[model samples]
Target chain A: MTAVEERAGAAGADDYEARLQAFTGVELVPQRRGSDPVNVPMIRHWVEAMGETDPVHTDDDAARATGRSGPVAPASMAQAWVMRGYAASVAPAAGHSPFDDLAELLAEGGYTSVVATDSEFTFARELVPGDEVSVSEVLESISPEKRTGLGVGRFVTTVKTYRDAAGEVVATQRWRLLRFRPPGRGPEPRALRPRPAINRDNAFWFDAAREHRLVIQRCAACGTLRHPPGPVCAACGSLEQDTVEAAGRGAVHSFVVNHHPKHPAFDYPLVVAVVELTEGTRLITNLVGIAPEEVAIGLPVVLDWLDADPELSLPVFRPVAGKGT
Target chain B: MTAALRPAPASVAVGDELPELAIPLTRTLIVATAIASRDYQDVHHDPELAVQRGSKDVFMNILTTNGLVERFVRGWAGSAAVVEAIRIRLGAPNYPGDTMVLRGSVGAVDGRRVEVAVRGENSLGVHVTGTVTVRLPGGAA
Candidate 1:
């Protein structure tokens, strides 16, 4: 089929009002396949970057010796792989959706969409590397908005599910999007928010304001640089450390774009990304001037600063221009 | 969902059920999650307009709901199993303070793919309910 037909298939029709009314609780669209798969190494980077010093992802022998099929990735870190095709666009031939696909679908359907508020799962089995999992998701339901706040429309409800490679259901994620009209606007000038930051914090090497440049507070006793600001070093358990900026370039590692914004002041098509710094340290920041589709792991990037506050310069990254999209 | 606590376990029997978890109903919690999820829609944070339509309080967001589901399930499933996929529906108004019970039933097992039925219930009735498809190690089948 043509690419336009493909994106429409992934995102659904522009005339959502009628399609929504005919919604039958579930619509299992064919997945627009991509090459990106969650490898064990990627999972390790994600877990370590999130400050989860768990050995399962880091120590291979320990994981294999544990009687597990293989190194078990953190369950919470599942979000890394489970959300790949969320906003994937059909081939360029698909054409611009009547609305921004999902946004227009919601607006046209009159469904007040919002972030997924709650979810529940039953882990029947564990997954490891070399396992090719087939993810099949379906549009469960769409709850239309029937209220407003600050003179804007508001409503929340959008649920979906994912299946594993074995055709077994691995995760079921229900997303609630609190869609609202602009606080004050004429017709429709609102925008979607970027997805929230992953559980990543409590680091000493960097801050949103200072752009630490990879400074590690030296552990007066043990000589080592800590990217993730910790009270004590893992090796010698030393409390003292030093701040240092290693090389500012690293691979893209992994990243996500937020077409559906979460904050009012935030810009749409928001890019929340994670980068593996030159010192092998990983950091999370906003990706500017690059389209989400253009983003790829292993893609090199450089640190860019933002002067939100004269005293506090926020550190963000931009795709090394000319290197790629 | 009764706001009672039970021994939290990773593995439950075919009929075993999960104790309901209740997060207090507050406009702030809704807004904090809204901000975190990058979902800036105001209806969740504004109650007056929420009341204007049909909800009791500003409704909770899908992002927060998804986050809560991720948190609740991980807490129950022992942070080990890989979450492959989940599909659910938001039934009644999940008001703050209302404890929510995530009910599950091991329906059928095929190798590692365990067919199960699960739902989220509160004092108001079934708030969010659906079936779950999971992959387990050994299957009774």
Candidate 2:
């Protein structure tokens, strides 16, 4: 697998994809026996936790009625039987699994975090008490890169064949897992700021900001300027509206330095401030290019445009150099 | 226990609702079920390890969630129903002291097969949403 690591490091994305595709249909693990056979105690615990009160799972009479020899394990328990328990999972035995190799191969491409996206089980028969189950997994498919809300990830699907002691296939599972790059981890493309909800009322503001212009909605009837564009002017109760391009100067009327609950799009100790613009309208925007401690009420600032992604542009403020008073 | 199994596919209809099942998310449940399912991930059983791993506390493992989902469907569909498949997407984490109430509706019925759309909600928000496909024996699909 070290060879795989070296190749993955040197290869391009297409080469890596080809290398990963090579593992398709390859068995990921040897036929591994379950640590424990299907038994009543484990079934009891499982049913208890799951709130499964089906009598056939716990009553011999019910099992007889259901035409089983005795109480049978729930069909869903197929995966549980063959799990590599606490010991094996935390500290795997030497002669590691090929699945580990696949994981390492994926992590080389910055896909480290894993989450089960979907699973489908097709059952052949239910396991009665004392039936030993063994499982072997094969790489089924690897999807092309997908952009999810979580991050960029590739879905790896595997098929696990579960068999009883007689080597008869009892069930099989098609399992799909997303190996994603956790947010803010490992060369991830920096996230864009959460998109502001743009509608007829506020689209003009964002559109003006995109052109590096600071515009405020003005009431044509009463000469009142509003920071947030609205359908009707509050001051004069007028529906007539116009915009005025400001000189892009302001003072920090109020501000707060945020240290927790971070978003990947912005740096922190983020300075969010209410800037009182020279046009006499106060709008909330982020303050930039100044240390958090340097931010004070009445601090003179100048407008700047944050081209957040190719689509979004926001008006930000920064303390004016040489006029920090 | 006395829930009657739907003997015919015709007996089940689209838009049928399954009774809601609310499982109390106890700390014992989170730890015990994780161990029972053989998932030793610290985020499922060890609070300190979970905290270090960036989770606020021990959370339910996907396996246990799968089990519970199957149980939810079976408890309604009866023991004789064969669970052909389950496709679930997890959302909010089920932290301890939150109750996940599962509500499901029959989304589709095709002869012997029925698909139920299931949603489980906890205090944080939607914990899990998915669909369960169950096939009944002796149906003329």
Candidate 3:
């Protein structure tokens, strides 16, 4: 079998994982000391960048008045003190480091890239200015190969123990990284539109939309039409209900253009509008077949069907060309 | 400034509302806080990497979210307040170009200990919802 195919098989995976477990309990970093003692300058930069105004982090008088001896670094900044600076981070690592060894071993198995999945910190005690700190790390665990969104990979977990000059434990971090093979850029299939929540109350509306028809729920007793199907009618407290086929006409009552935190199913700069139907009820739906800039309040619109898929359909609106309020 | 200090133990009762704080989710804020927190995850700083990893843009990291929540609570509880614990879970991501408005209400109060139910909402939806437990500076009754 080819090397790549054999490494992907069950026996090859088992053989590879055995070597990874050998590094368990091995110290990756014996004692990497902080370049500088915990000081106000670093703390100041942290709080300012975070927009944190906690007096205990930077104001000595405020901290002293509050019972602390002086300013205390924010507890969340525990990892920052021992972080390798930009210069060291970009420089090539010395050949003797075990970190390089572990990385090389992983690369041999085709796990050449990494992404952080989770980090949990439990602080034993808060650090103060002028306190010297150092850190040591050991492999906590490495999972067998598993499939993930990034690709097939294994999880490598480690425990970093932070200590003060007195060797007392100040904090501990359980960090997990997913070392995976990069999935080359390929055209992903277009996402299907989001499905609507259909139940007995609203099944008829969607069923009608599936056939390219627009229907509204109407109270049988008082004839109050509602866009959303409900159990009881609000106008006359009637349980009796029926459906009314809409005239397929409306006007935009209000609208908004969505730009961020987007879903893969929908396009960006999406135009969503609340359309007031001719029957005196409103439905919140998306506007299709038009530019977002062309949508405005009181713009006349006509009903359109978005056949999202064979099993699902949605009612979207399109602005009527040259139609005025 | 004095008025912003610790609320009197008796003065803080259940159902009190803390003023809302709106934070603009700028790209600079997202990248700087991630680095400041020593989080080198590319998804929090590199927009291209973020998209490749299934995000529209670089988003705020959890550590930064925790820090923002702590800052919001401390601003209300005053200088003497101690953040005993912060328990939060992320929902929708806080992408750059959005504004996250944090709002909280007092849930439980046992003398100096107060529990605040906090939620941060962005343009998409609820981004973070969690409870922060703090100890106001005062003798326990």
DockQ of each: 0.06, 0.30, 0.17
- Locate the minimum summed-lDDT window of 10 residues in model 3 chain B: B1-10
TM-score versus the correct structure, for each prediction: 0.37, 0.62, 0.58
* Candidate 2 global CA lDDT score: 0.82
- Every prediction's TM-score for the first chain? 0.42, 0.55, 0.53
Compared with the true structure, what per-residue lDDT tens digits does model 2 show for residues A90-172? 67756878888998999898887666767777778778888999999999999988887557899999999999888999988
**Which wins on lDDT, candidate 1 or candidate 3?**
3
lDDT of 1 by residue, A213-282 (tens): 5453445677765555667887789766665656567778888888773676466677788888777667
Instruction: Give lDDT per model, in order.
Output: 0.52, 0.82, 0.79
Q: Which residue ranges in model 3 land beyond 4 Å of their true spot?
A: A1-10, A92-96, A106-115, A144-154, A180-182, A185-325, B1-21, B38-42, B49-55, B84-93, B101-135
Q: How well is each residue in A218-264 modelled by candidate 3, as lDDT tens digits?
A: 99999999877898999899999999999989999999999997997
What overall lDDT, based on C-alpha atoms, would model 1 receive against the true structure?
A: 0.52
The full ranking of all candidates by lDDT, starting with the best, is 2, 3, 1
Q: Comparing to the true complex, what docking class would candidate 1 get?
A: incorrect
